[model samples]
Target: IELNAFVAYQREREAISDSAPARQLFNWCREAGLNARGLEHALLLRDRIGAVCRRLGLPWVEAEPAGNPEPVLRALTRGFFGQVSIFSSGLRG
Candidate 1:
């Protein structure tokens, strides 16, 4: 299983608790002498898919801003706290 926690907002605001373990993992990797600074990436939907969705006349229905900040900060301050979001899209392939 892959455990990734982060803050995200799209159709609606989806805030994730800080998964500092992941951060620590990155730090650990660096300490372990692994060159992984540029190993992670992200694709903003609006930047990439928004135009297509709009041009295709798709019903881009989405909710307003909403997310859990308390948990997010808690996870960041701590190490093992955060939320998990599953990636179900095959779009990145």
Candidate 2:
């Protein structure tokens, strides 16, 4: 689910590279399932992408908070369960 959201955000941002907010939104999406170390890596990527977009004067789409954290949490939850499903399924006949 987290990957899905990332893919969706990537596609949306690709469609609109003239807005800074769009890039910011993508940054937020990338940080979704990250830990402290992971977040740092994500920040680096976000900063680099944002800088390039800004330098190029591109429009970026920003992500609006999904109103609540449930959706974002749910995506992470799905990703967790999905992984478990794959591993456990392999153990079954």
Candidate 3:
């Protein structure tokens, strides 16, 4: 659920094309027992539904005690989009 929400966020914000994760998410939803139409509709309501996850914080679990949080996040972002840029100019996402 959280993964879908995150995908919704990235697509809606234009941070990435929906083609990247959005198609994967649709297939995932069908496998997870959700009706594809309903899931798509819900994802379309990203601002009200999906954004809640971002507002409340991402759906995440720490798997390692020794890992740094920032690197893990950077890794995920890069894995998802293939490239990432961190502004040394103090830009906030």
Candidate 4:
């Protein structure tokens, strides 16, 4: 994710843990030579979805603020990290 966007998310969620999932992901992107633009777009899309859900009066469960997102992020990474690229590409195509 965009470093700025992730940092903003971490701050907004009060995610003050040492886990640093966003940092790790950003580092992985850099190491893998992936562009930050894609991650930034994803983060922006997340924001837009949250906004739309609010506007439409739909429950956006994941938007609930939490003190830490490490556990969730870690679990999701473990479960679907490998499939994310394929899933995203599928969506684009």
Please give each candidate's TM-score.
0.24, 0.35, 0.25, 0.36
lDDT per residue, candidate 2, 1-93, as tens digits?
A: 343444555565456556585456546555664343444466578789899999999976554554345655776799999999999999995
Each candidate: RMSD: 14.7, 12.9, 16.2, 10.8
Number of the candidate with higher TM-score, 3 or 4:
4
Clashes of each: 1, 13, 0, 0
Off by over 4 Å in 4: 1-28, 63-93
> Using alpha carbons, what is the TM-score of model 4?
0.36
User: Tens digits of per-residue lDDT for model 1 on 1-93?
Assistant: 111222211111123235554566465546645433333332343445667887888866432234435554564556543222123234444
Number of the top lDDT candidate: 4
User: Scored by CA lDDT, what does every candidate get?
Assistant: 0.41, 0.62, 0.55, 0.64
User: Clashes in model 4: which pairs?
Assistant: none
**Clash number for model 1?**
1
Off by over 4 Å in 3: 1-19, 45-93
User: Ranking under TM-score, best-scoring first?
Assistant: 4, 2, 3, 1
Query: How many steric clashes does model 3 contain?
Result: 0
TM-score of predicted structure 1: 0.24
Model 1 worst lDDT run, 10 consecutive residues: 5-14
The ten-residue window of minimal lDDT in model 3 covers 82-91
Superior by lDDT: candidate 2 or candidate 4: 4
lDDT of 3: 0.55
